[model samples]
Target: MTDKRIIKSSKVLVTGGAGFIGSNLVDRLLEQGNQVVCLDNFATGKRENLDLALQNKNFTLVEGDIRNYEDCVRAVKGCDYVLHQAALGSVPRSIKDPITSTDVNIGGFVKMLFAAKEEGVKRFVYAASSSTYGDSTNMPKVEDIIGNPLSPYAITKYANEVYAQNFTDTYGIETIGLRYFNVFGRRQDPNGAYAAVIPKFVMQLMAHESPIINGDGTFSRDFTYIENVIQANQLAAIVSYDNIKELQVGSKSVFNVAYGERTDLNQLFNILKKNLSEFDYKISDVNVIYGENRAGDIPHSLANIDKGKNILGYNPEYCIQRGLEEACKWYWENL
Candidate 1:
């Protein structure tokens, strides 16, 4: 395994800085004494997410859309590294409006990459998705073995991996892609139609309402915590290309950023209910409604995170139970 190196004394640009993952990353970066510039249009990102960040003198919020070339250019100026987290994330949302998703995800990705290249940023790190593992039924997903994409969102993420590689090969710009699994934690919006299952369930239970499961509650996922994702990003930004090249497949590489375990929906519900019940006893009695299985969703997901551990020194600190405990506490206090 590689030794961990924290990113400090540098300037970093986080594209979706006001979003859940981006804002969290921004906070950690700032804590490490790095100058952080956040580029977000507040489309899905919340202004409150960056409240603590706005207080820091080292943090700058650039209100901009990634789709516009000028906005991307303006964000990348004087940055040493680019953390590309700006993208429309939901599979259903992309299916409904593929054009807008494509324009923002694919089109905007290229613009940011171009801007990073022009600015001579040391490295470009992006958020890839586990949805890219579309039809593959592998027990543990490895970096190189991916099947056909199942949704428009998945296609866009896979295209990002391809584009990052192309940019690295053709322009010599360094890039790393962190394929995030079912990430959940604080600040995750639970009210949206495309809300993630964990936070959505948390909200329902808090309201003494039944949380709906899309399947028989047998389908499982490698639910990664936000803190683990922050560690992966910091490692990806600082790790040398030469050290990573020794382990990576090509000029650019992607690593699975997950907790390396799976938890079915039933177990997840029980855990959340149990955790939240500490604050509100009635939550323990909250029932769950099982619905039809979501189309395009796989039965199980488990990440073989050996690549990240060996190369980037990514050691995830939170498991499903631990993460849920933390998440439940945050929701109880904040919501």
Candidate 2:
């Protein structure tokens, strides 16, 4: 059995705790007997995400924005571990409003780092992105090799890694960045224009609406499950400390949190459609409109998870199909 007791009694602060990934992380932390403080502005996150955690005695929900220094300071104070999951995600959203994305993703991230460092937190584990691979056409992207960021959102995420390294080198903060692939599971919003593809497609299919497939439907992704991401965050938070730096705390270094597998959009759609068809036989031939290709999206993305496996003992439990099935079920019932 996994040692879920590692974080017991630890006062942890999770920014964006009301968001999908952040709320999930908060749930896990509360389950482990940790005193979790959730700070979210709710720009994109919903209050419903933290409903379960609110019932826990150890969980405290703070409505605040990370961009504000006072809020960051208040949230970071007395926290043992800081899991920074707050950010404005989505490339197209960033492309449409680069300033808002920059202010929140980059500016807010830096503010959190400063506050965490000042508060003398034990460790900082943050959500990085596979989008950092940017224009690199490599089949399996490695951490050391990266390409120029194709979009403003990618640039902010990449800047986070650089800032983390800088904090380690200069301020002596302990930090680890988990580069997540296309993560999907329950609680992912499906109604927004900036919604992720999996939830968006599942919602459309369930609503008996046409799901638009961007590009040729051949574009692939290493769609990771939300549970795997929660596992990675826990591992990153409590890894044995060896050479602790001001920026990085744990014994293990940065790692790619993914299943190390590829699944194209076409295959993904078919899997979800087939699974949902069990409920409604006549749901076949749901119109799939292939529109113009997205600007910041990479043609394909696959991660080499050897680093995570060796360092954090990270093992992903679900593949794209399994994750999509669960996600589709949630959308069918909820959305």
Candidate 3:
């Protein structure tokens, strides 16, 4: 448990602002009386996701790509803080095209880092991935101890962590990295070949279709809520410089943003079915289909969130069930 820190009124840039998680962060920032600018190229980000945010007077959307230095420079201007969430986000997507993943996740990240540093931004907080824990077999992953990356996507994300470690020495900028677990909630895309399990399952179950599990359903994850992730970002932005330094591992200060627990795919299926049943009883009986395990996927992932609690004062408000219930309601009404 940690004491909460309030975000002050400031100009902030959200790199992938038109996407699922980025859009949510934009909305929350606007409500907190902050000036928010969202930068997106619409490559994987959707235009419709910014509908509500576009309506906010405090929100400014920058139509640009992180891959371009000019665009990054343009977006980072006059920003007090940067929330860098832009990247090609899926393991399968990366395996299919490692070049694109490397270009965006690695190259694009360095571009943003320089942009923030050039503009003298107060802090640079970006999303990291739990996939960095690859091949470790650690029950509850800690920040300092990590294993070799399993896939191209994981490799790229871990590379981001490595670069961020040298920011203070290389660029004199404060940086915080959030190693996010399987984050799910409202606005998270439920389509595409790389769609996450929760929303995809919800959408399929709503349509009375059986979900195809990628593995035998034994693979587990820490399935964190979007609100908790949002809080993590908010808290990270305002973290004290000394505290930020204290959380450093090999020069990078990263925290695992998760629910601090685990849920296997089979349990996830049943949980979604149970939650959706309250909305429509008929959907409860929908069966799940099991398939072969994915090539680069790990068997289990859980996080040790003590570092975040002790340092950033993060205390997650929603559990998996509560998040699933809310997500079900949103999908029922919006989908």
Candidate 4:
């Protein structure tokens, strides 16, 4: 049996709590009997995501931006744990407007950290991205070995780790960074210019549009599910050890939050087509247009999740096919 003592009485704050992964974390936290506060600017977060939580008295919603110090301060006050998930994600979006991405991703993160430190939060856990693994050709990306960042977005996320470590060393804030690999699930927006692959494809297939494959469909990702991220956040929030002196606040001791598996684009497409074919057989096609390879995209990304499994007790319950099925159902019903 797992000990419930650590989180049972904690007051939690989830930044960007109205977004896909953040909202799901809010649900899990509230289910475990924690007093949860959600802070969001609604830049990318949808108001409908919080509909279920609004009925719960234990939940509070704060309209705010993390880039503003006062907003961060107000949100962090009296919170035991902070899950910072607010950021501008996507390489194309970042490439189009690097300034806004930097402001929200880097500037907002620093402000959140400073506020968390001042508020005396127990532990600060933020969403880190696998994009930090940039141009490195290694099959299974390890935490220690990283290559140069290829995009402005990658640079901002990498900078968050640097600032996180600096805050830990200079101040006394405890922090853990989970490098998420292509997280997708329910409540993920599929109607945006920067929509993620799974949701985007599901929507396209449902609408009878060809889901554009960026390259020759050989590109692949670990494609972690959102539930795994929720687990990581909860574990990181309550993780305690006797060695406080040896602990680094911004240590950037990162872990790959993935299932340690890889699925190529073509394979994933076939699986999606097979599953959706029950609804409409005409959707099955091997005719994805081969566009120019996107800039700043890595050829293949696989995570070595042993560290997460051993240290954080991370066990992902869904692989890509299963996850995509759930995602497709959600999109089909909602969109």
Which segments of model 1 are wrong by more than 4 Å?
1-4, 248-252
For candidate 3, lDDT tens digit of each residue in 217-311? 99999999999999999899997879766543662488999989899999999999998888889998899999999988989999999989988
**What C-alpha RMSD separates each model from the true structure?**
1.7, 2.5, 1.6, 2.3
The estimated TM-scores of all candidates read 0.97, 0.95, 0.97, 0.94
| Residue runs of model 3 more than 4 Å from their true location after superposition | 1-4
- Model 4, position 3, has a per-residue lDDT of 34
Off by over 4 Å in 2: 1-6, 243-252
**Please, what is the whole-model Cα lDDT of each candidate in the order they appear?**
0.92, 0.86, 0.90, 0.84
Better TM-score candidate (2, 3): 3
As for model 2, its CA RMSD to the true structure in angstroms is 2.5
Whole-model lDDT, candidate 3?
0.90
Which residue pairs in model 3 clash with each other? none
| Model 3 clash tally, residue pairs | 0
Per-residue lDDT of 80 in model 4 = 92
Tens digits of per-residue lDDT for model 4, 193-281: 88988877777776678888888999999988776777777777766633333434333356789878899988887787777777777
Q: Candidate 2 on 76-162: residue-level lDDT in tens?
A: 879999999999999999999999999999999999999999999988999999998898877698776778899999999998988
What is the Cα-based TM-score of model 4? 0.94
Instruction: Report how far residue 327 has shifted in candidate 4, in Å.
Output: 1.9
CA shift of 62, model 4, Å: 0.8
